[model samples]
Target: MGGGSFIEEVRMLGQGSTSSSWKWWAVIGGLVALPMCLCAFCMVSGLGVALLGTVGLMAGEVRPAREVAEQFLSALRDERWEDAYARCAPSFQGQLGGPEELARRHGGDRRPVEWSFSRWSVEVKNGVRQAHLEGTLTTASGEKYAFSIELRTRAVGSGEAWEIHAFTMD
Candidate 1:
């Protein structure tokens, strides 16, 4: 039986059966590639949308979460409470305390005269954009505080809108 099976396989190969035809392979390849191509297309399109949403386009220009964090930090450092609060997500604005309370907490002795931001990194995780910035906060009296900050952002609308979720400092 073993010898007969090996001989039958060789005979089929020599006979050039339909299974070995180029047309058959092409049809099989096309069928397999159809779903594969569709899946790739879906992934690419989804990634593109996520990127756009994360970067946030305005007036045909990109405004990334890092810039948002930069602006917020600058406002806080300058004691511009209203401006800083304006950039915060509504949910965050009224969370632990009011904007005025935040201003008092950060604006008093904690406020730095100027900041030096370095090692800026931006990444997106599960549709949330996280901006990591590390640097020094210098006070008017020449006091420097090394600090690390993370600014989070998330898409809110149909892949076209975004908001600053929150931020943490260390």
Candidate 2:
């Protein structure tokens, strides 16, 4: 009679029946599983978005050096010796005396000459910039010469300012 009274109390509380007990277990299981599923989904989606953003940024940032290289070649082609020399490193200018001296030493232009640039590439590393230029230089004597030149520059002070550090012909 005592155990029978406890069983009656459980039935009245709605936990003694099989269907009600199973319903409570299902609710607890769903509460535990939902958060884990949502967390895994967010992690996978965030990684995908980050990867795409990085690739886009890298492509957008690569054009500045190419533009600089083109401007440099154009100056040389137009026989703008002063402008071309201005693009050289200040240290080189001081060592060689001046741009005019540098031209006299390396310009190789006894008379009017024609020049064209080809096969150019520019690279930037650790705040230093380098450019490779390959082209043909035709003297007034009608002699066609092929040359490869490397130019190095560095960022000066703050902002986007750059200064040439060296120019070499090979």
Worst 10 residues of 2 by lDDT: 161-170
Instruction: Write one digit per residue (lDDT tens) for candidate 1, span 6-50.
Output: 546545554556555655556568889999999999999999998
**Candidate 1: misplaced stretches above 4 Å?**
1-63, 94-96, 156-170
Task: Please report the candidate that would top lDDT against the real structure.
Answer: 1
lDDT of 2 by residue, 1-170 (tens): 25567446545555656566655556567788899889988998998899889767654443454355455545555557677667656776687677567557555553226666666665776766566666776655676777655566554567453334444443
Global lDDT of each model? 0.67, 0.60
TM-score of each: 0.51, 0.44
Global lDDT for candidate 2? 0.60
Most TM-score-accurate candidate:
1
For model 2, the stretches where C-alpha displacement exceeds 4 angstroms are 1-81, 106-112, 156-158, 161-170
Clashes of each: 0, 1
